[model samples]
Target: MIAVGRIFRIQQELDCVALYFDRFESFSSTQVTSQVGLSYDSRISRLQWTDFAEAIPKLCCKTLADIPLIDDSAYVRELLQHAVMDDLLGPANGPNELIKDMSVRDRYLVGKLAPRETLDEGNDWGNSAVDEAEDVVPDDLEVKAKPAPPTAGKRTKGGEQPKDDEALGKGEPETSDEIDVSKNQSLVPSSFGITFCVDGEAERIEVEARWGRYERIHDHGITKTRKNKNKKTGKEEEIEVKVWQRIPCGGKMVLDLKQGPVSRRSPD
Candidate 1:
């Protein structure tokens, strides 16, 4: 059964890597023909295989003769070491960067392991990795699925439950269980509140608790907009977005739009 499990997992991993290679090939072809928005060079082939190299050892475990099936941490360290060696020989900076250039999973793992250093490093990542990293979406994109207008109201036995439409119109706070914290910055605010838009304009207001500081971040949401121009007509239009904010929140309050009209969208 254990052997069966290992084979199954290995098969799945290979299948995923094979699919990735196929996609990269397709993307490469599109680049050559200018059909795709982005272009990828032949070097992308190397980055794609790097992920498979890390997985193979783990999947084979004791079956492989060269390396033992140590803990995941040990395996990851070994993989990083080998990757670094390969990059150094090829005139690249290090293996860690190349590993991150491989796939999202590898990138995230590398991100976690690498020390918090200067993000704006002046190095030639050969355009391919730079484009790859830029194209990669952060894990937090999943958090955007949260409902907008982060209203955090508690339920009561005797009182009426608020309706969703009413909440949307009222610009209520979103309820969330995840606490928002930055690995590099301090998010501790003196006050808390919800943010939204009006007449295609965005605004944020403080929700001063009548009681005290609500340190608990229940949930949050956000709305975004983008501008696009017509290729043929050269006309521009604003596209509005209502995304669920993944940030941490503790309380809710009724928005006092009478405070002022939103002149423009404010960054949080």
Candidate 2:
């Protein structure tokens, strides 16, 4: 059976922790008999661990604490200390026998080990999967503006009224009502500058005229009154009339990553 031991190191400067695994042969009857005739391989398989340590400096950590706070009883920091001391002492005839003996039984119980070729192929597949999962946007990407609403009371190029036969059959002509409302509503002019935080600094952007539009709105005050004669009583009565007025409202601006900041002035 083969046993695996995990080692972890917290890199405070990079705010990242690195974990590595060391594999050694377990002291089973089969392993003992096989080792008697096998030659000792002194070269250590620390390539993956060395690569991980090299990558630690470039990692970013956003956690509140420099080191993770976990239960010390489970990790047993003394084991790591002893392992380091043993490595510094000298190379053994083979992998550390004590460490191999203490390996978790379940992981190697199946007696099947992953081949180095399979692991390398799996790493390539993993890298490709990560690339596919990433959301990549092009620098020159442009946002398509929404199509403008058809102008009220405006004819098409052929001077024909746009018809909705389905709506017309229901006695609800859409174009006329929309045109009347658009023409009756009042619009106010407004403009404002937008502020944003760029690279931890406040950036103020001016509003551009094209992106702005006048908003139609109604106010509380009475704008006018009307007198009407009752058909049945033949009496004239004064009635309060509600009026739609256009007021000046601030314009809209869009923040585009590809184009930086974009501003549009409200239409007059």
Candidate 3:
């Protein structure tokens, strides 16, 4: 019965190949899956075997011996490994009779196959072996010298500028309007309560300006127009004018403390 179970499980593993191929051909087309009404996740689970098969081709396997099998069962892995080795060694002579005729019951009773151990021990041993091999270098070997520091006034290999001299070069003065325009260029204008004209239709928008403590509103010159009567003809005509006022400064006066005045001059 034990021998029979092993053979049955081996046959089931072989049958998985055909099942996987069918799924690969089915879900390979996006239009077909949509027409057949299958969700993407459901289709993915059905085609996992295909992924394993595709990985084998990338390994450039030339013979059955080159194929890799990652099976959970130790018995299944041993059976597959023996079958592949036999095929590569003697392709003309069919399957190895030794493996085919062996009884799983007799093997278990005689303890020919040891119990499987956890993979953690094997992995730790491999890491320790690598560390031991790397430590074998001679201690007397000379080590390479470290690189020298970069000199001043010389550019680095990456062409990065020095941080200490960023303001050494002359640059154009920046205005408040230019700075504000550049900061808002990347954002969507609609989010800022702004609108744009479309198809020759005008759009009305209102904007508020805010200033920090060191910032002030600049006053550009203003112009105004008014209608006036001509002095001689008594005819009204439009005249353009610009106007501004100046205030007297009280600080400009200087007092003469030592002078004594007794005469007053008449107005001339």
Best-fitting candidate, measured by TM-score?
A: 1
lDDT string, candidate 2, 112-159, tens digits: 112122224453212211121111112222223344454447656898
Residue range 158-220, candidate 1, lDDT tens digits: 676656754544543554333222122232222245655566353544543212111112232
Q: What order do candidates take by TM-score, descending?
A: 1, 2, 3
Better of 1 and 3 by lDDT: 1
Per-candidate count of clashing residue pairs (backbone under 3 Å): 13, 16, 0
Tens-digit lDDT string for candidate 3 (109-214): 2211111222354522122111221221223222333334444566656886554433323233332222121122232121222445434343322333221111
Once fitted onto the true fold, the runs of candidate 2 whose alpha carbons sit more than 4 angstroms away are 1-37, 43-143, 156-268
Q: Compare candidates 2 and 3 on lDDT and give the better one.
A: 2
TM-scores of the candidates in the order shown: 0.18, 0.17, 0.13
